[model samples]
Target chain A: EAGVAQSPRYKIIEKRQSVAFWCNPISGHATLYWYQQILGQGPKLLIQFQNNGVVDDSQLPKDRFSAERLKGVDSTLKIQPAKLEDSAVYLCASSLGQRVFTDTQYFGPGTRLTVL
Target chain B: GQQVMQIPQYQHVQEGEDFTTYCNSSTTLSNIQWYKQRPGGHPVFLIQLVKSGEVKKQKRLTFQFGEAKKNSSLHITATQTTDVGTYFCAGADTNAGKSTFGDGTTLTVKP
Candidate 1:
């Protein structure tokens, strides 16, 4: 089976510029997630989607960040007016369901964003 | 809010040495998982523990979940250069309906 796929493995943008990252999850997976991982820090959940419906996005910066999982297979995460602190790796993962205890997650290579 | 913390942010040992990393949670976790990320790579799932005091092993790696469900540990035996990476623990709280990841423990093996 193919693994999760992400586009533009790396990106560089200036502060206040807008950037978007795209992800295509493994086929047949029902849960998709977007996470932001800062250097020397663990991944922070930005948003989660279950079959096109958002399951959680409490940590998402509503004012600057937004994500969508249209058709429930692929996802896109966008950040407008990017800040220097927003320079981090954005990872995309997918699982069969919300059963984190039982389901194994497949992660993408991730898009490393550098905001100058 | 739930928080997961891993101890020994970094560890360096000889190839024949044993290394261990611990993870603690502010709240009881319904389950805990382990992931490994090599430098410049994304995390890959290692294993998941659900039952209290559960212990699982994979080759030279051993994972244990505390009986209290608030702590966990990963131990590696006779570390090799291939074992160099950051190990992360992610805890899931059923009530919170989410999982939290620890900062991770980076391990280095010196041959």
Candidate 2:
């Protein structure tokens, strides 16, 4: 079986510019997540979706960041008026369900974003 | 908010030597999962521990969950070049599968 897939493996933009990242999770995986991983740091959860509904998004920066999982299988994360600090890798992961331990998130080769 | 601290931040090991990384969580975790990321690759799940004071081993890699469920450890015996990468320990937040990853420990193996 194929793993979670993400597009635009890399992205470069200037501060104040808008950028978006796309992800396609594994088939039948009902749980999807978006995370931001700065260089030399761990991935931080930005948002989570169960099927088409959002389960959590407390960490999201509503000011300039937004994400959506329209059909539930694929999702997109966007950043508008990007800041220098927003230069980081955007990662997408998927799991079988919301159960702790039973749900092992499978990550994709994140989209590395660099804002100048 | 939950936070996981990984020790050593970075480790350089000679091939055939042993390597170990520790992770501590600020809050009790229902479970802990480990992942490894190659220099330019994505994070791959290594293992998960759900029981308190649990120890699981896969070949030379041994993972341990603390009895208090707030700490964990990963030990790699006789490390090799293939073990080069960053090891991360993530705690499953109370929000279920939502995981908060630790600042990974980058391991460099000198051949």
Candidate 3:
């Protein structure tokens, strides 16, 4: 079985520039999530998707951030006009279902975004 | 929003020393999980505890769920350089199985 896969392990951009990251989850996984981890901080959930529908995104910064899993197998998170504070590791994870207590999660190497 | 916290945000241990990190939540949790992230890596699932006061061990790592179900702990025995990383504990409450991860405890081992 393959593990979660993400593109562009590292990215560098200036403030106000747009950036995007992509992820391909493990096969047969039904749930996907996007999180942002700042330096010295735990990951903060940005959005979650169940199949092709969103399960939770209340914490997402809608004004500047957007994500979509059109076919439910892959996902893309975009940030428009990025900020210096947005420089962090963008992590993507997937599980078989919402029952994380019973289902294990697999993570990718994450995209380290650096905003100048 | 739920409040989940972890203690000893940072710890330094010499080789062969034991260390532990604690997790606490304001609300009762249905289950708790542990994850470890090595330097410059993403979190990888370690284990989950559902039953109250449950204890599980993996090699030198031991995880315990509190009797109150709102707290948990992870103990590592005889630390090694390979044990260096940030450990995060997350709670999956009865509400929807959604989890809130606590700020991780970064462990540094002196070899």
Candidate 4:
């Protein structure tokens, strides 16, 4: 059973630059999520997708952040004109379905974005 | 907006000592799950509690869900160096599919 996979374990960019992170969830998983974890803080949910459709993205910064899961298996989260405040880890997680209470989520290694 | 809080933010203990962390929520939670993340690693699921006042144990780790379903605790006995990590508690809303995670409690074991 392979775990969730993410690309570019670490990234560094200047303020106002753009950055993107990719995530490939566990096999057969039906739900995917993107979270932002600032240092010393818990991971904050940015967006959630059930298959190719978005389930929730209320916390996403519409002006700067966007994410998509075109095939329902892989996802990409992008931040344009990134700010210093966006310096945090981008974590990707997956679960079997929306009934998460009955399912456990598997997380990827995460991409640490450092905005200077 | 829902919030789940965990404390104390950090703790250090001798290898043979015991440790515990608490999680509280502003609203009643339908279910709660726990995860542990080692330094520089991703969070791994530990356990889940659904019914109010449920208690589960795995080896030296004991998890308890409050009778009110708004609070929970994780207790570790005779901690070892391998137990060093941050433990997080996530609470799921009764009406929503997403879960809100707490800041987490970092535990350091002195070997």
* Tens digits of per-residue lDDT for model 1, B16-108: 999999999999999999999999999999999999999999999999999999999999999999999999999999888889999999999
- B61-105, model 4: which lDDT tens digit per residue? 999999999999999999999999999999998675558999999
Report the error of model 1 at residue B61, Å.
0.7
| lDDT measured at residue B78 in model 4 versus the true structure, 0 to 100 | 99
Model 1 residue B110 CA deviation (Å) reads 0.7
Native A-B contacts reproduced, model 2? 0.80
The digit string of per-residue lDDT tens for model 1 on A42-71 reads 999999899999999999999999999999
Model 3 regions more than 4 Å off: A98-101
Q: What is the C-alpha lDDT profile of model 3 across A32-91, one tens digit per residue?
A: 999999998888899989998998898899999999998889999999989999999999
Candidate 4 lDDT over residue span A16-107, tens digit each: 99999999999999999899999899999999899999989999999999999998899999999999999999999999985855679899
Q: Measured with DockQ on alpha carbons, how good is candidate 1?
A: 0.83
lDDT of 1 at B106: 98
Q: Looking at model 1 chain A, which ten-residue stretch has the lowest summed lDDT?
A: A97-106
Please give, as one word, the docking class of candidate 2: medium
Per model, the share of native interface contacts recovered reads 0.83, 0.80, 0.69, 0.77
Candidate 4 clashing pairs? Answer: none
Q: Write the per-residue lDDT of candidate 3 for residues B24-95, one digit (tens) a residue.
A: 998899988899999988899999999999999999999999999999999999999999999998887767
Please give the DockQ score of every candidate, comma-separated: 0.83, 0.74, 0.74, 0.80
The prediction achieving the highest DockQ against the true structure is: 1
Q: After superposition, how far is residue B57 of candidate 4 from its true place, in Å?
A: 0.2
